[model samples]
Target: MEKREHWKSKFGFILAATGGAIGLGNIWRFPYITGKNGGAAFVLIYIGCCIIVGIPLILAELSLGRRSQRDAVGTFKVIKPGTGWFWIGGMGVATGYLILSYYSVVAGWTIGYFFESLLGTFRKMGSPQAVASYFDTYSASPLKAIGFHGFFIVLCMIIVIRGIQGGIERACKLLMPTLLGILLICIIRSVTLEGSLAGLTFFIKPDFSKLSTQAIFEALGQSFFTLSLGMGAVITYGSYLTKKDNLASSAVMITFLDTFIAILAGFAIFPAIFAFGLPPDQGPGLVFRSLTNVFNAMPGGAVFAPLFFFLLIIAAVTSGISLLEVITAYFVDERGWSRRKTVLTMGTVSFLLGIPAALSFGRLQGVHILGKTPFSFVEGLTANYMLPLGGLMISVFVAYIWGGRKAIDEVKVGNPVFITGRIWVFLLRYICPFIVAQILLFGVLSEFTSPRVISFSEILRYYLGIIDIVIAAGVIIGGAIYIISIKRAKRREG
Candidate 1:
């Protein structure tokens, strides 16, 4: 095999990894999730989840990658050789590819909106209704949707094709700082607006009465998903680390930077929403619609409008590079293909796969599979099942199969006095996997059941019937493979 690339510096790895963690979800979904889920209480719970679940997994993945110095799939194979455990990494690579397909379509919207705001498009709209209608019209345009989607893919391809240190590390060094700088500017302007204090109060004040079980689950889920865990992105980035580098500190710093940016995103958005007397829980529409109205009415609307969307574009590109790199890493490591061939071939195919999702907003909006539109179905498949399953399995593999003691030994190579080894292993063996399993079940069950459950029978009838069967079959198949792989390994050992 050819030599592999490593990150040139620890700082580059930190920025690149954190940039992979920070994405459109931070800018749009997180603020809305926090507002509706008991504000500061939810935020606190989220931070705890990060410490308990997110950071441990980050350590596990980073250790696994650095020890093997291979792609996600190859890392598993390197450690367990001829075992079914490598399929976990295969699932991760597949998950990244699946997510990148539809994710790029939405990332494209950010770029399209950035250009639109830059060109003074929102200035022409007089009312919130008109602004919303404009978004609907733009989203419903097949030509524009596919055009921007292809554009975003091409941007990612260019960055990922340049090799690791020169491409991903270099681009993130520029993009992440710029993203934070623009975000600070937006927050300053947002808070200075009259009546903005209402938003801040709502965001910072936590009411225990408002906190629900569902909200707690939401916090746990966000903490896991927000850090780009279980999707091969972290593992792929970790593959470039050196033995001298501290995995524990690197994971914590990446988590800290990601969480800090997410909270800052709330400050940038919530103040503006409350300043304009708009509802904070507008869900996903808050960014495209309500924010447009806020921009139209604000003092420096034209200037800040472009700045905010530009920030979104930057966040999208930074995250998009990592997703594409996940796929690129697989082919380069496993198939021995050149980075250029892998990136171009996989990038083009990813774009083609996304065309259907792009069209789902326009021509295929009415079509439904299993009571969901094409876009929603794809989103649900990955978010609700693949990601959480991947996370849960990784924890189990590291704790039970690879042995947590061995994993920590790998982690402690750089930090000789690493103190959290026992606690981390315990969490991985018991607490973390259970929490991720809850997230997985909630994600799957919530799709078929209402948020307000009135009876046990309701859950049994709506939630458990089909999903339970699917989960059971998966467990059985996975168990069989594990048993077989282990028996084979023992035979080889003998």
Candidate 2:
């Protein structure tokens, strides 16, 4: 059989990869998380983690994928051979599927907001409380949310079914730059607001007291998810790259662009919140509710409000397309399914699964899978636990078992400049996996152990307690031992 063709242009690959990275999470989650977690201190930690942990893992996944030239499942099978590491690919595809189910629902909100903004619905909505209630009403309506979600899912499926070059690449090329441009415009406008400097200071100022076990762990998790690392999204996308493509440079570019958008979003949003005297820690409603109010209060509230939401919708749609492609590609490659079949089947399944999240606003509010939690339990489990575990597995598989060092060598073969081998090896072999595993274990334990309504002082005390440090250390050591033992067994076999 003839060899499969790769992405013809670097722009296509970058756009597609970036489309996966820049999503609703960046726009909605980043600002609020930054505010609650010591503003600038958290942002700094997040950036550090992104470079040290996110970039290396991205290179590892891309190297693995490009070398194998296969979907997520096939990539693992090629690298690890007889080992069951290929199941990581399956996990990734599943994770993408699970995420898109609810993710599309949230994406639907952006879509709805885009139209509402355009029509000047927000112009008359004067108060933050009114904007908050608007979100509450819409979020609780299952039928309306489902309608918009279906629209978003279909749009994603249409683009994904067209293959990498024709559909995914073209959309990203047009959208990514536009998304960045909108963000910069928003940032410029926001920074000029009265008291905007306070928001900026809040985001950039460091508070060492805020450094706790849980905060560090949360930062680690955010770094992983925000960059779309460890869930096989990057790896699966990487499988399409040509041999001459520079994995290191590509990873760095993707990380930088992703981080820039996230930070820019913070700059745009927080200033507006402060300007309007809205609460900084508005939880998930910060973007949908608080920012909507800010737009209403602005001079040209109607015009800018719609423009902001339009950019958000575009960013979200592109990201959704990438997630769908991961699963769609797996089905096409592994099960020999047609692209249309794969797209439709996955979309239908995701659409149905999204109903719970949609209904969580009202009727299903009492439905708790883990315990007494409401809307975010399912989201939290997948993001905090499954994503990190998948990442740890990839780190170990590439760094130790699957010849990631060898793959890195292959990746650097044609480049004029090379990444520092020692640093790359150190991160791949020790630092990345250790950090990821620590976050995963500690995050789970803390969630289970910590009270939901604890006082601020008590929460602070819990973070600095001896127990937290021991837990973090134990998790890291456990990962190192697992990887070392696997390497030893492989050596013995050789």
Best by TM-score: 1
C-alpha RMSD values across all candidates: 8.5, 6.4
Clashes counted in candidate 2 amount to: 1
Which residue pairs show backbone clashes in model 1? none
- Clash count (model 1, backbone only): 0
TM-scores for all candidates?
A: 0.91, 0.88
TM-score of 1: 0.91
Candidate 1 residues 1-494, lDDT tens each?
45799999999999999999999878877988987786777787777678778898999899888988999999999999998888899999998888888888888888889899988888887767988878788888999999999999999999999988889999999999999999999999999999999889877887777766566667777887788889999999999999999999999999999999999998998899999999887778888988989999999989999899999988888889999998889999999999999999999999999888888877989988888878788888888899999899989988999998899899889898676677678778977786788778766667756446435434544453344335435544654676677668778989
Q: Write the per-residue lDDT of candidate 2 for residues 1-494, one digit (tens) a residue.
A: 22344686987888879879989878887887877786777787678778778888898888888988888998888877888878888888888777888788888888888887887776666656777789889877877787898899989988887777878888888888898888888888898998788787777778777665556656777788888876778978898898889888899999998898898899888888888777677788887877887887787777778778888888888889888888887887788888779888988888888877777777887888776433476687778677888888888887788765585686685454453544566777877776787667655655654365344434654554345345446544764676677668778989
Off by over 4 Å in 1: 449-454, 457-494
What's the C-alpha lDDT at position 255 in model 1? 93
